[model samples]
Target: MSNKVTKFFGSPWGQRVSLLIIVILVMILFQPKFFSLDNVSSILLAIAIYGIMVCGMLFVVIIGGIDLSIASAAALGGSILSIFAKGSGYTVEGFITGFVVAIVVAILVGLIHGVMCTIFGLPAFVVTLATQYVLLGAVLVVTNGAYIYHSDFGVFYMLGNARPLGIPLPIIIFLIYTAISAFVLGCTTYGRSLYCIGGNPVASGLVGIKTKINTIIAYIFCSVSAFFGGMILVSMNMMAGAATASNAIGSVLTAIIVGGINLAGGEGGIPGAIFGALLVGIINNALILLGVPSDYQKFVQGVIIIGAIALNVYTSRRSENMKTPLKPSKKTLDSAQSAKL
Candidate 1:
């Protein structure tokens, strides 16, 4: 029994699950209201927006790439949508036009990211970081450095806040988005290629995988997801600005890391990512419930990010150490000796 217990905790999934249970237990003991229906809904709502972005970012991360521009990209999406809707007096026709244009813009941004990374051979980090500034600049220009508020409660508002059967629309959208991402990554050939390309792009290319196209698709998907989430977010707040979803990139990446997805890429899954998001949300909520100052909360988040990365590195090294080189079978060795004789 002791050995079994030890083994369970020794596995990666087991360790993560244990940590989640421990965190939840701590929250319940210290803050009984943590599980209140309203509080739980609030936590889910917060998780939903970032969770959608996490799904998109997972694709790039799985392919050994990163996008630091998620927040800026989201801001651009929301700002564009708000501009169109507001410009047209918030009618259904205006909202649809804005939605389509925002999505197209997202696709274009993603295409640029993909081309730069794959064809131009730029580092994902540098490319995304640079584009992040460019995107924010675009947002500023469009909004004239002002927040665009949703003047009327219409389709735009319903997109984010509508409750169907007592569940928030954003939450529903998040779950659906996650499910689709999981399906693509787990069930499709394209998804399998992502892992291969992430693990070894050259090798994947040699094996007939269209590495460049697949990578481009992944980046495009990431941008589209970011935009979709951003739109929902702006709708919920009834406003859009450069600061909208400003912390999204950090939150999404942190969730990905805490879920044990390697930054080096080629090793991660939907369940782990979701678990990481849930844990982070819970921690943030706990800090608030405990009356931790905003500055301290940021400090804690930073520490968590650093600690999670360190833990990932440590575990990766440990796993590598556990691998034993293959040895020749006894029959093969005997045959060699016989042949020598």
Candidate 2:
């Protein structure tokens, strides 16, 4: 029983459980009425969209890769979908086409990043930074710096706005994605290879792991998740623009870091990312409810991210320095007795 208790509280899930308690306490203290079912449902709904991206980003980060292009890719996806839907008059087929095209475009962007990094030997940071600019420019060019609004797409709006079986569709989708990601990352051989690659790419290659393929797949997953997140944003707002959802990249990074994922990679999991998103979302909502200025919010987020990163580094170093005492062997004991004699 004692061992089980220690393990439970020592795990990532335990930390998240503590965070949830803190969140609840803060919410109750600041706004006692925030405990209503409606607000709780709304919070869950909001988490659904960002949570999906968080899961994918966790995977990418675990592989020692990063994707700053996520926000722009999301904007691009939303903008393209809105524009195409507006031009095509909001038919079911048009919606399908637009959605498919957006996802495909995002995946291609991921492919570009992966191929460039692998083929040209560029750093993931530099590659993703350049891709971010390109994606932003593409969104601006495609949308012509305009917002596309299509109110006639009742189906899309409903998917975003309505709850079925007492649960939001976005939440349901996020849950499904989370389940699949957990399965892939935790239970599959490929997932284990990803961790090995992140730990030591050269060593993993020497050991016959296809490091390149796994890295590419990780980026692909990141892009796909961002694309879906963008779709959700568009559906929720019934509009899309180049500047819409600009704050997500930083927010997502902050969440991932806070969720206990190491920036250097090879650690953290989907559950950590989920909890990080939840904590971030709850904090943001609380700030808004308290009427804090937008600038201050950004400042707080920056501070939180920096602090989390610092903590992660410190903890990692400490863990590395920790040494387990070795048991004495019979040969060593005999040698010690002979020295005493």
What tens digits encode model 1's per-residue C-alpha lDDT throughout 1-341? 99999889878888888888998999999999999999999899889988989999999999999999999999999999999898999899999999999999999999999999999999999999999999999999999999987768888889988999989999999999999999999999999999999999999999999999999999999999999989999999999999999878778887898899988999999998998889888887888999997557667778888997887678766765665346565577899999999
Residue pair clashes in candidate 1: none
lDDT of each: 0.91, 0.83
RMSD in Å for all candidates: 4.8, 5.3
For all predicted structures, in order, the TM-scores are 0.91, 0.88
Q: Please state the error at residue 149 of candidate 2 in Å.
A: 1.9
Worst 10 residues of 2 by lDDT: 318-327
lDDT (10s digit) by residue, model 2, range 1-341 = 99998777655567567767887898899897677887777778778888988888888899888988888988998888887777778877777888999989988988888887777879988998998889999999999988887677466676577778977888889899999999999999998888898898899999999888888888888988998898888888888888766878877998898888877888888878888999888877777777887657678789989977776567555544553235565577899999999
lDDT of 2: 0.83
